[model samples]
Target: MLHADLDSFYASVEQRDNPRLLGRPVLVGGGVVLAASYEAKASGVRTPMNVQQALRLCPHAVVVPPRMHAYSAASKAVFEIFRDTTPEVEGISIDEAFLDVGGLWRIAGSPVEIAQRLRARVRAEVGLPISVGIARTKFLAKVASAVSKPDGLLEVPPEGELQFLHPLPVERLWGVGAVTARALHERGIRRIGELAELGEGPLAAAVGPAAGRHLYALSRAQDPRRVDTGRRRRSIGAQRALGRRVRADDEIEAYAHGLADRLGRRLRAARRVCRTVVLRMRFDDFTRATRSHTLPEPTDRDAVLLHAVRTLLTAALPLIHERGLTLIGLSLTNLDDADSMQLTLPLEARADSTLDSTLDALRDRFGSDAVTRAALLHRGTGLTVPMLPD
Candidate 1:
């Protein structure tokens, strides 16, 4: 098993595209810090922190707005490279994946050689730094990647897994968070080797029973999970945060339409159709409400999904007016393969379908902004941050 993770994905992309930002402290995002370059990190800047605080930490950092489209394109290209390296690839996020290369030893050389080649390929082709960890188990592999970061590689041989793992801090074990670390510290158990000396009963008393047993087993290097690539997503969705800004009904509707358009395209691209359309809303006060409608038939057509979302949005207008919406999102659920779609449709429906296909092709060739709905002409879709992969 090999775990591959891109180092500071969003910030690295910004630096990679602009030579001026290279080797400089870079921060990405506006209201909050989504990613910070290693230079910025060295100055105490961290992701998901307040933008103002990040700047205060690294006053000289170059902050850049996120480009969702570019990130999406890069993620697709990276995943393609991963799949090419090994068929059994499990994508954990936009910039991380797990590749099982155990079966390719004879054909691809040893695991260490494969990992080196994979890292070299990513840097040469994608122009990004990636850290890879190789181990007999997935959990250990993931931990190894973190231990050797920022364009580094490390492998834990089966014969010496314990020797490599014992001296590490207890926090390296799965499920050991700040609270757990503090609890362990109080008990004078700061290392994995020390924790391994405790019995399950003592470990459970320190933490909860389940977490204690889990940690006890993991401290012994007993993770049994595998890299799975056949998992299917339960839903597809997109959302935009509205901060403290109060939005008008028309503006909110336009954003909703935009989310629908993006989600619809994703559904079509995945060759899936959904039966349920759900509308999620958040008010300025931070309270949220959800409304959903299930279609009689699954459909990936943009008009159908957008219309359903609009109906739900219309029904929630009263709440929006009372609470003042600050966020809007759309989700499609209960999906099925597009091949299951009916072979026949009414003449008008078929005509609309043809138009949808044509629009999709044009957008694919020219770009998402090549064509836009009349409603979005005045109020743009707003900034969309690229989300982690499913």
Candidate 2:
């Protein structure tokens, strides 16, 4: 069984502590709607919506900057409670996780009893409400959690999975986005139960074999996936929206180099190196394209990755001009664990990798802006990307 959510997560935390903000429409960011209270969501304010637009929808909404530190602290507290209750626990995200209580089924009386205790502890100790869903599979557990929101708990026994899942909207299936849902709807399959009636061949004809078959399997609640121990991130990449204007290739390459440098630092910190570097370019018109090339060897060298990215940018210059490039991104994939210690290699081996790590250490101890590539020094923007602690 996995309890897979934080009920109103960020919004609920703010409302819980700040009694003044209770019951009023609230949003959690100044620039964009990072989160919105359910009341604010009713008025069309939603996550990722522009703050200005959210304000237009709910004029009285209290918008606050994100308090990530507070959220992280709260997550730790909740996970502690979860660990206390169950031995086999897997965290999927900061606010959502899985608790495998198979061992405690007898000790805690039953899964239901354990869930009740876990929910009570969260509401009492963490001071935030959450939703819990119990099932034999991770997929059904997630579905159950979504169905039972706002401090609710739902349990779906193994034999009752299809009965509980099939009648749901097509959107309930994992990876079914709005576009996929619309495609399914066009085939007159709005409900998962309806999809069950469309045999494999006809379903494949409608949405392509891979997607249709997957959806059909999920519709039947026939998932065999287990709660994995979790896999290390194969790559780290970041991109910034360049507003709605065309930028020259040299200017964009400079920014791309900065992004690669940051990614390289993260890779080194994670002790991971990549053999493939991917470049993503997005145009002002919203069309995007990506290209990837394998390096000579797996390396976390910034110069190697940036040189590849520059070559890609040079080749992509024509398309950038044609589509009006508005965004550029860099990613390192095909990873292997890197060594913290260095050794002499072929002439093409990293010359700056060691130097980069040293500088990264300085920047970490001091501040990032304290060190900069001499070329980027002229521009003075140190580095920009969302970084999660490795």
Candidate 3:
């Protein structure tokens, strides 16, 4: 398995298209740091950081607005090169994918050679630099790719997987986020080998059963998943990062409604319906809370989704008021194909579906901005980042 990822994707695209941005710090997005060039990153700028703070970190950084269409085009071109290299491709996101070149040893040559050719093709054809990592398992391949970043290629052979993995930091494990890292750190288990020596029972006692089992298996390089091209997204969602400024109740509601509108359109566009509406909130202190409500029936209608979203938001309002909300997001999960939906008895519900399809058609023919909800007429709709098809 080979994991190929573009380096600083959005920022790289900006630098690629313009000569002035090359070899200089580039920051994409105006309000938040969506992507930062290696130079800006070296100056301590990170994604989702406030633009003002990013400037304070890198005073001479070039700030540019996001060009979604251009980025989408570049991603498509790179994926084309990936498919040309191998048919066994599993795209994780717009800028990264896993390609299984194990079968092509007889025809295409070694994995490293194939990865070198893949990188060369992307740079020559799409004008972008990509890093590729080869390993026996997906988890290790992804980790290797992250380690060999900014136009690099590294491979972990089956015989050396353990030798290469165990010495790394425990934070390098797939599920070890900030909280998990802190837990492991406080326990004096900072390395993968240290965590592995703690035994599964003690690890489970430390981080709960599921996560413990997960980390234990990964600490031993035991990932069994394969690269699957037919896999569909289990959930579709969007979020907006609101700066530190406090917002009114109506303002927050407006953002939630806008997110619902975008997500509903995406669900219907993909011919899928969701049974669960999840509300994700981030407080000013950077802590997060999630609330989910499962619908009695699956739906692809905007009105139905908006109602569920508003209900979840209302339930989280007290927490938001107490903690100070900084970000709000909505995710539609428990998904199924649209053909599986049962017929509704209510005439009003059927009419709502009709209106949703009509609006989707209009937006598809014209543009996403062509049709707008009355509530979001004057308010700014949150930024819509590009992603793999739902």
Which lDDT values do the candidates have, in the order given? 0.88, 0.80, 0.92
Candidate 3: Cα lDDT at 372:
80
Highest-scoring model, lDDT: 3
Itemize residue pairs with steric clashes in candidate 3. Answer: none
The order by descending lDDT is 3, 1, 2
lDDT, residue 332, model 1: 94
Per-residue lDDT tens digits for candidate 3, residues 284-356, read 9999999999999998888889899889989989999999999999999999998767777663334444878
Q: What is the TM-score of each candidate against the true structure?
A: 0.84, 0.84, 0.89
lDDT value for model 1:
0.88
Give stretches of model 2 more than 4 Å off: 13-19, 76-87, 246-251, 339-353, 363-390
Better structure of 1 and 3 per TM-score? 3
Question: What tens digits encode model 1's per-residue C-alpha lDDT throughout 60-82?
Answer: 99989998887877777788889
**Residue 199 of model 2, lDDT score:** 76
lDDT of 3: 0.92
Best by TM-score: 3
> How many angstroms is residue 212 displaced in model 1 relative to the true structure, after the best TM-score fit?
6.2
What's model 1's lDDT at 72?
79
- Model 1 / residue 301 / CA error / Å: 2.1
